[model samples]
Target: MATTTKDRLIEATAELFRHQGYSATGVKEIVDAARAPFGSMYHFFPGGKEELGAATIRWSGAMYGELIEIFYADTSDPVAATRQFFEAAADTVRDTDYTDACPIATVALEVASTSDPLRRATADVFESWLVQLDAHFARNGLTKTQARSLSVSLFCLLEGAFLLARATREHRHIRAAGRTAAAAVRDALEHRASTVARRR
Candidate 1:
């Protein structure tokens, strides 16, 4: 399928936003990178950059959320899959020279206080991710409470590790965080399994 002009704009914007953040990336740069006409930005996004920013956030957020599904779906051993997922994240950061990490975290931090609309967009993306993670854990035998809590913890761990890893230019932070998260996941699963056994 050919990339539509609208898709190109979103993809280009997402790429720029992921690397340099929303404020640093200019409209010209977005168009140049996208190979899109200057007028197309307004034509596709009538409200301009802020509108485009929100769209990028939602699009990138959904794309990352799909990655979670790829990792954890239809698995007999979600715990192991969780470990592999984090390790792969570490690998990606390293491979990208630390420029590529979470798609929305940078913008979320940037616009959290300044832009109410952007802030809400980020919040929505985050909750969507949590929903996917929570469902994955819940299906793997964790109780609802346990799944939600673990979902938040794992989310926090990854985001924090990505921040640190990018700052230090060290991918090891993500790798170590992955190890720690895998342990937490394993512990939760084991505890849940034991409790259910006791009930049985």
Candidate 2:
């Protein structure tokens, strides 16, 4: 299947947004990277950069969500799976010279305060990823509330670690975050187990 100009533009923009920030990235750069004609951008995105940015965020979020699901489905322990996910993420950041962090983190922080549409789009993506993690926790025997809170904590740790790791070019922070996240998940699961035992 031939990729459309719009697809190319989104792919390129998402990559740029991950490296640079949303405000720092330009439409020309995106089209140039995509190797698409300049006018095709406006034709595909009449609303211009903002529209394209939102689409890119959503696209990146959906792709990351699928990756998360794959890890959980393939692993026997969801908590360990989550740990391995962060470990892999930290390793990628190190291997890529600290340039390969979350696709949406930099853009999300930059646009969250300025672009209402883009902010909401990023927020939705973040929430969706959390929900994906939460679903994995729930499937592993956590109650809805427990799973949701644990997921939130895990994601916050990841985001925070990404910020620290990128700035420091060190995986220690992310590795620590992974440890904390794993403990949080394990604690939640243990608490749930105890509660269930008491009920039984």
Candidate 3:
């Protein structure tokens, strides 16, 4: 299917936000990158850039979450799935020349202190991803609380690794972080299994 004008605008904004961030990226630049008309932005988003920013954050978040689901879906072993997910993330950074990582982290940091709506938008996205991850972990034998905690830990690890990787232009940080995360998942799963066996 052909991409619509609104889709182009959102995609362009998401790309710009991923690289330079929110305040630094202008509306004109987004339209230009999207090859969308000026009026179309307001037409699609009456609240203007703020609205678009929130939408882009949510949209990108949903897409990224779906990508995570795909990774987990491809493997039944949670540890392998976690390792594969982080390895792929590292590859993505290298492939994009370190220009792209998490689509909303830069914007989230920039507007977190200033914009209430945008901050909420970022929070919502993170929460959604966490919920999805927790579900996946739970399916793999973790209790709800353990799964949620592990999901948060993995998210923190990935975000921190993304920052370090981009700053140093090195994939070592990402690889190390991935290893740590995969180990954490493996350890948690093993512990849970042992407890279940003891109960049985």
Candidate 4:
């Protein structure tokens, strides 16, 4: 399916933001990448780069969230789902030559201190991802607190792994994080089961 010019602009900026970051990615570069007219960006986003950046952050965020749902949809086993996600992410990094990880992270790190709107966009996006993962774990057996905690743990692990993987040009960190994450999920489930049994 062909994308509209606006979609192309957003998606192009998203990729550039993932690789080069928000500030480094120029409006011309974005238009060139999108194959969009320079004027069209304003037509779609009058607030210019910041507006586009925020929108792209959100679009990318929702896309990542849906990916988790897709992985979870195939299995009820939280361990398998967790493993699948990290492994796939590692594969993607390798495929892209370690240039990409979370699409929002690059921009988030850059604009967090300088741009309030972009910072909030990133925070909201991160929270959205956390919420989705929390729900996934909760449905699998963990209580709300446990699920939320695990979600945060997995998020930190993945983000850290991505940083290391990019720095070293190796995917092992991601896989390692995946192993620890799966174990944590198992521990959470077992703890829940044990607590439930004790109460019985």
Task: Output the better candidate (3/4) by lDDT.
Answer: 3
Better of 1 and 2 by lDDT: 1
lDDT of 4 at 35: 96
Report every candidate's CA lDDT: 0.94, 0.89, 0.94, 0.92
lDDT-wise, the better of 1 and 3 is 3
Q: How accurate locally is residue 164 in candidate 4, as Cα lDDT from 0 to 100?
A: 94
Off by over 4 Å in 3: none
In order of appearance, the predictions have TM-scores of: 0.96, 0.96, 0.97, 0.97
List of clashing residue pairs for candidate 3:
none
Q: Least lDDT summed over 10 consecutive residues: which range in candidate 1? A: 73-82
State the lDDT of candidate 4 residue by residue for 1-200, as single tens digits.
57999999999999999998987999999999999999999999999999999999999999998898898765779888889889999999999999879888888889889999999999999999889888888887788999999999999999999999998999988999999999988899899999999999
How many pairs of residues in model 2 come into backbone collision?
A: 0
Q: Model 4: residues >4 Å from true position, as ranges?
A: none
- For residues 113-185, write the lDDT of model 1, one tens digit per residue: 9999999999999999989988888888888899999999999999999999999999999989998999999
lDDT of 2 by residue, 1-200 (tens): 59988899999999899899888898889999999999999999999999999999999999988988888876658778878989999899999999888899998888878899999999999999988887788888998888889888888899899999999889889999999888887888889899999999
Error of 4 at 12 (Å): 0.6
Q: List the candidate numbers ranked by lDDT, top first.
A: 3, 1, 4, 2
